[model samples]
Target: MTQPVHPPKPRPGDRVAVLSPSSGLPGLLPLPFELGLARLREDFGLVPVEYPTTRRMGSSPRERARDIHAAFADPGVTAVIASIGGDDQITVLPHLDRELIRANPKPFFGYSDNTALHCYLWNTGIVSYHGGSVMVELGRPGAMAPLTADSLRAALFTSGPYELRAADRFRVVDRDWADPATFEAEPETDPGDGWLWHGPERVVEGRSWGGNLSVLSWLLMADREISQDLSAYDGGVLLLETDEELPSAEEVFRILRAMGERGLLERFDALLMGRAKTWSFDRPGDHAERARYARDQREAVLRALAVYAPDVMAVFDVDLGHTDPQLIVPYGGLVRVDGPARRITVTY
Candidate 1:
């Protein structure tokens, strides 16, 4: 197995590359993208540089791959972040030049479909961040969520053990990004119920792996990044989250069951499940429906673990992935899960 190496951290005044490895949402929704760029400058005190395809909606996979190479190879660029996520980022994976990226390792931040790149970076022996899309977190209306900003700041500029905390308030329901008013006020939030831990009460520390559950399934099918060796993931921490699509509980179980059947599920000593995103613009539901959806997802996960990894310590509803106020999970970096004290810490 390749040991993961942490890339050089970006200083506050350094220039960070904003590339569109997936969807060029910035071209479609300039409001949020502009807002996000501004915050990167005024709040974080860092300059953001955009590539040719950063806002080009119909850019080809080769174009996106070129942007990635330029960003990493440039001596002035200190980091790279995705503008937003789309469905077919997997297409960009094959075009990437592994040697270019491995030779010039910079802190890369993204999530959702960007999981494709995160997995690629992990395979190249580089640790990349699994959360913090500019459009979603940095451009949030009113102000950046305090928790999100603090967590991102730590990950971008520091190299130390940072503890992850359960959010006191969070939002899974999103407002329409097309409306200008969505950027004028903050979205409504609900009280957090805290993280739910299952299995034996013990401590587990390992490198973090995994990303958006649906995307991971796609990678598994393509046989990309993942090692064929069953013991490659032994003792590693697994990170799983659902997107805004709100897939059925049965679908989630089937994906995990496939992993279990392949002798892959039992390799992890711990698992961290992101809070299920229960609402979408197309399927806006009432409070009751949202509550039931979350409950069902949790049950499905527990059922799968019972058969494949009953001894694994699992934490559910962690404020990561698609949820509002997301925390950055270090892909291939150290993660510590303490069951007895109910504490989680991530090394960035």
Candidate 2:
């Protein structure tokens, strides 16, 4: 197969499918979901069309797949964005009709559990997106982060080189989304620490690959979505980020070790690791604890690179994943990492 194809962009007035390809959290948490819908209409000027399973918690994989098929097959729907990310989107992958999705290729936007969908779309030879979930970025408490809003707008409505900036102020702490007050202001954030780079100073420009590290591990285990001919990913930029579950540094290293064992780690010459989310309800670590967690995770990543991808250029703290201001990274699209210049840019 050749490089992935970039699907047409959606217009401001176009109708975008707001389906829950992952969790129907929108059903359980309507506060953020409804707020997100209103933004799509009032702010983005796009009509959000919801599917049956979009808000129905515990819907079957086949039911979700049906909604996806319906949305893509509908010419009225210009783009499809997930309501939110969740666990078990991998189960919904097998239910998807590849031929149908490939035939009616429209841009699909999501991350986390939606990483399953991203890999699927990449395999389908259609470029998808790695961020811009309704319940997350669009429905962000207080207001959408300016950087996130601009990045998403470019990905949704335009096409070209989009340089990604390091977050001056980033957040890792979480609050009760169920509380009405949570929507009244932005989530508490820690002081900004710009990206860290490792490896020789060089420029690596190629199509982007990789997604939520945990999701990739599941896909690797299930032998799903990954190209049998690993050479297809040679020279592609690898994107890695951990979710709110906050997998141990050991687990993160193990996943990369598995990839190294498969000779997959060396395929990409560059990597952009999203800023790690160090806190969660399960592990509510304080400032010092958060710093320690982030440090350990970084060390784990560097260890993996040293063992398998020694020559690969790496940048840490990319604002493209589970954080206050998540930027859109085009799945299977061109990404240029300029090490000497300390810059990263993606083609939307």
lDDT of each: 0.92, 0.92
- lDDT (Cα) of model 1: 0.92
Query: Candidates' TM-scores?
Result: 0.99, 0.99
TM-score (C-alpha) between model 1 and the true structure: 0.99
lDDT for each residue of candidate 1 in 9-102, tens digit (9 for 90 to 100) = 9898999999999999899999889999999999999999999999999999999999999999999999999888998889999999999999
Q: What is the C-alpha RMSD of each candidate to the true structure, in Å?
A: 0.8, 0.8
List of clashing residue pairs for candidate 1? none
Among all windows of 10 consecutive residues in model 2, the one with the lowest summed lDDT is 185-194
Over 4 Å off in model 2, which ranges?
Answer: none
